[model samples]
Target: MKLVTLAIICVLMLNSCKNKSQEEPQNQVKVEKIEYASFGKEIVASDAIAAKSMASHYKTMKTGDSIDSKMVAKVNNVCQAKGCWMRLDLDDGNEVMVKFKDYGFFVPKDITGKEVIINGKAFVKEVSVDEQRHYAEDAGKSAEEIAKIIEPKRTYSFEADGVLVVQ
Candidate 1:
């Protein structure tokens, strides 16, 4: 009986190790505070700065394209289901979904409407069928309900390598 107990303990320990190894990798993005240059220069709001930058970079971009740059935008909403994404409200009223490059970053739920800047790549693409289903599941929608929803014509996704939570 003692030998059997020891074997069971060893098995459980091994299983725990395996599960840890299978866990998703951490987000590698870094964050830093923005610096103000001088007192006389107009200190641009974070949303304003991000808007200008995104305009310059994404103006000529089309669907199915991608670009890497620093962007600023206001956090319109965040994912309440998984906290994996934040919806950005661009100055134009167009919204973009933003996600950390990995699972490493986090933002406070109350930060909605706050401006932020992040270094990352913006992807314009259509959601694949499988991807749509996966997202639906993550958003806590039932599979049957998700299947009945219409897919988007296109989507703008941002993958951030680093983020700055600006005021």
Candidate 2:
């Protein structure tokens, strides 16, 4: 009976240690809001929060960089359909399409002329011609308009979670 009790006590002690070791650090990292650049402006992420959380934050991309989760520049273009989205231009000369999250909020179409900050993932992809046409249709474009929709050769797409609209 004594040996069984000792064995159980050892197991419990080991389990407790294991659990404690698996716990995360007490000091957690907080995401800070940041602003990006414009079409011609050379704005960049000048904050520490962006530096620590995202490795590629504010770094210019040549290719294969998707604008999904990164602080990126705002592209210069207005969503002509419903004035819902403000596009962002990435450092790689790739246009990162920016829109409010969950359709919860929207910026003025004229805001496209300003600088903004976005935190999200960046995806470099070639959207199929069909998908492009579909988007064009959704934007209330005519068949000729849909045909004019430029198929994405390679786009650095940014899907922002939280955005800080900066002038």
Instruction: Please state every model's RMSD to the true fold in angstroms.
Output: 21.7, 15.9
Q: lDDT tens digits, residues 28-142, model 1? A: 4667866522211123434334564575455567877897666777787766665677778767757777887766766565567777776668877677767766666755678
Candidate 2, residues 6-79: lDDT per residue as tens digits?
99999999999988877755456888774432332232445413322333443455455654454635447756
Question: Among all windows of ten consecutive residues in candidate 2, which has the lowest summed lDDT?
Answer: 48-57
Q: Evaluate residue 70 in candidate 1 and report its C-alpha lDDT on the 0 to 100 scale.
A: 63
Model 2 CA deviation exceeding 4 Å by range = 1-68, 134-145, 149-152
TM-score of each: 0.56, 0.49
Going through the candidates in the order shown, the clash numbers are 2, 20
Q: Write down the TM-score for model 2.
A: 0.49
